[model samples]
Target: MGDYASQHSFRIAIVGGGISGLYCALAIHHHCTKAAVSFKVDVYEQAPEFKEIGAGIGLRPDAAQLIHNVGLGDGLTAIAGGSGDMLYRRFDDGGEIVTVPLSREGSVKLAPCARSELLELLKGGIESRGAATLHTGKACQRVEGLGDSVRIHFTDSTTADADLLIGSDGIHSQVRRQFVSDNATFSGFIAYRGVVPMKSLPQWPLPSYSVAWLAKHRHFLVFSISSNEALNIVAFVTKEESQVVHTKESWTSTCSRGEVFKDFEGFHPSVQDVIKLMPEEVSRWRINDHEPLDRWHYLDGKVVLLGDAAHAMTPHLGAGGSVGIADG
Candidate 1:
């Protein structure tokens, strides 16, 4: 996009179709001309649909700026609730921990929203610009790099050859597996997430601000995703190791109230209140992460990796999605 003009008329084929793929396509489309890019920016995903399968994400200042840079600034803010004035409390005794007000000026930028909602927003924005094409359900089984182009083989028996390929797939990316052979480092803790409707609230004590439960071996995080929706709660606990251990939480794992209560019985009553308000159908997953990589792009010709595929990180700081947004 700077001095050298693209070799083709299209933007070329893109490999993944989640938030990262969409953003990458838009960023490339923004900087390069229709002629500067290649033939088509085709995004390949393992899923049949583009909907978000997971929960919510926290948007930081850098993340918001990434959204705004891709021209989704207005819509992104419109869908998310204000978390700038969020208050925090330790449910151990329902005692207040600290109240950090973001509402003063730049606080809203640090808030979060449902992952599905934000992905939908990013998809709409990317398509609105008429820059890229997406191919879902066509998982990339393997990618072969040609000096001047690339060929991608899919599990669905279909194959496509293109100029550039971007692997925006998530942490379990097959594309990344071919490149990086290391395994995901386990974080000792697990997160239980669920959304409780306000109508179910006996007496809503959740601060206008997001709250966190810093219990002994367990902690819970509470915040609202939107004004009209239920509150999103995430409970974290140490995963007790067992000789016959098997994973109960995954990309899609649902749990029950009994299981949750068994984990957090030692916390405060108010914490109990929050847990009691939660539905029996809660979700859980062990926190896993990747080591930081020196570079994201593996430009053997026109192939590169983006987002978590390139550098998956821990979610303790709640920057998982933000990092993906930034990479795009």
Candidate 2:
């Protein structure tokens, strides 16, 4: 063992409870157990419980393999909506333009999962290990480094110390601000996302296919999630046509149904029908991305950044969350 490994017990503090944080804890626990290293891990989340607000996410081959390696393959597969080819369609008439397969022969298969369901699986995996403890409703206000250890201050007038800290917080991460002194840049685009019952749209295409429609400057994506029980929909619009006000107060804002319909007035009838089914209230958030940092660690490598806090990307590739899973 190295000099740092000579400590009585190594402690790791994870600053977020999202996919990245929970998965990181599981990874560290499994790795240290395999090496017979004595260590303690804790995950601090601001929310009351583990949850994901987004509609759906696609896990690439690498991510799936990582999950399997972490002993979550069976649990994840149980709720996974099997993956297939992605189709690109014309926006005006919903005509198929091209099809792209997401998996190859004799290779790790791609999987699509509801964000919340995946979170639940990760939470269960960590709990089953009986190693790390989760601290909820503990918002990290600031973090400080003291020679060989780091101390984190929370809003509840409490603090915790650790040998190392990992910031898996999201784009608006408080940890990233203190450690990296950086902020996420607005991508000049916004997305409207939500999920609806698959039964509500009986005339739609088969639930197995994931579809994307490309217009001049906007696009719409639809896919099945929750074992084909619900359909997830996302529509992107440029900043020009849809002006986003109140730039800094909050990222998400509620809009009326009429507003959404007006944005897609010239869209295809099929697209129009889907938009109409959307509830009266919808939430829109500004898309933000950042350039890759040359370095992601601080305080003599005692702190690190992961996921959106480190390298946020546009959703056009649909691999943002998967990238974080890979990092774990």
Candidate 3:
């Protein structure tokens, strides 16, 4: 097997139409193309449409370098500001904290990319490469090991059989659900996140970086997500609002600015002023965490977990998205 003339030809079945799934297909495709080997890749997503949400991602130089290595530089650079900076402020007063110039530390290319923008760019690139198939609205119901091949059954009444089955479905992954009874964990606090147009902030310059505001009640985050996008804002507070949240499986939902402003009363009026500008509720989620499992691989001879499906976190370090992109 070590000295065979024919390289191993791969047929990959990726479950989940999220970034990790798409990225996996892309990676496999690029590798086979480089090796001049034949392979097929397909991704299954449960959504009717893959609409990128209001979340903003913070990427370190290492993460950006990884994207470049995958030959996604142009697409990454398109919706991402690789030359951005990082700014900080006090949560209460909105007073200026020390500003840190990111991306100046050697070959680091950092930027805040809107989750939607990143998805659009990544999906577009995947299609342009002609290396993978994305089947949106097709949810993976089951993955069964069938000797040398794996069988993938979907809710859409279709199935795919491939040499390798990948479960990159995400935190509440059905693949994970089938593999283990207890995996996901609750991290104990909920996050209220939203974005306001720059036009909403007349006192600020076109923000050239990301900012973190720390207060007693909760910590707030603001950053410029993309060139044409709004200024991103997120607040992580310890409230019993989890009981008030609408959905059970979902982590986030939309809320009015008044709801969020109530928590930051003693802080700065500038903060409340900013809140008043928001038109409506965006998204909120009660954060959670899980202990790393001994076995990420499962199902006799097939299936593997990726992204939050594998490792969920509280995201206190601003590296959650960075880590996810790095995992990709």
Candidate 4:
């Protein structure tokens, strides 16, 4: 056990195939190749395949550089659009409170991409390597430590042992529970997120930038993606209108357009116009975050938590995923 190269190849089990999990797997694979180490890594995803439903992801300089280093720069460049200026506007009147250029000195501009596209880019990278295997529909039930190694129990009555267990399973992570015993609490906010085609909103002129419409107890984020073929929208509001809804068991829930309209009646006409373009059925997710954990690993560092499982912060700062990529 002391000499990894002298013995059999090291085994790494990654639970969850989301952004953080795949990114971690790729990062680990890259490191293993560079260090000339013998290792086998596998990713266990509960879903049948890698799928993500969200508005868009704004990749700052730090995240962009990380993705570039992971050897996905060409894919990212092909799928994502660059956001020139970001605007914070008044929700009631569409007045700009601030205008900030997203590009930093000696760095690439901020890239806004459809979340699903980014996931595919990552999934492709992992699949292309042939060094990692992805197991789908295998939900992780619990994890146990056996001396120097860890055993992960799946709901399908299967088990896997690994020298290292990386938990990128989002906020309701089973790995976090086994290690930290922390609970995630709702923050009295729910996000109504969706995306629409740019052609549908021909009357509305959208800038080549990201815009945030803010009002009392609510905000809307809009940006371009897929080569400006569509616009992603995220509407945030208090949980008052969602009293009858419970999102603890599952973060995402489907709701009618009327429900969204009730909560977004006071927004500016421009904002409302964008909301009107959404599909008849919409999905809303509860905003939940956990208290900071004292530690992120267990079983003598054999198991660890990353991404939202470690620090599920508010999306206002847009650093949650960025921080997780860094951890990977």
Model 1 RMSD in Å is 3.0
Clashes of each: 12, 0, 9, 0
Clashing pairs in 3: 52-116, 92-268, 187-288, 251-285, 252-284, 253-283, 253-284, 254-282, 255-281
Give the poorly placed runs of model 2, Cα more than 4 Å off. Answer: 1-5, 103-106, 206-208, 246-252
lDDT preference between candidates 3 and 4, better one: 4
- How do all the candidates rank in terms of lDDT, highest first? 4, 2, 1, 3
Provide the global lDDT of candidate 4 against the true structure.
0.82
Pick out the ten consecutive residues of candidate 2 with the lowest summed lDDT: 245-254
Query: Please, what are the lDDT tens digits per residue for candidate 4 over residues 1-328?
Result: 4454259788999999888898898999998899998899999999998898756887777787888897988788787765567888887778878888876676656668888898888989998987589999989999988887889999999999988899999988988888676688777788888888878884754464478888878888888888778888888887763583565324257788787788878788887788789888887777777788888887888998999988888777877777888899
> By descending TM-score, how would the candidates be arranged?
4, 2, 1, 3
Worst 10 residues of 3 by lDDT: 1-10
Tell me each candidate's TM-score: 0.88, 0.92, 0.88, 0.93
Model 3 — TM-score against the truth? 0.88
Candidate 2 per-residue lDDT, tens place, 177-215, comes to 895666777787878887887789858663345888898
Give model 1's clash tally.
Answer: 12
Off by over 4 Å in 4: 1-5, 104-106, 240-244, 247-252
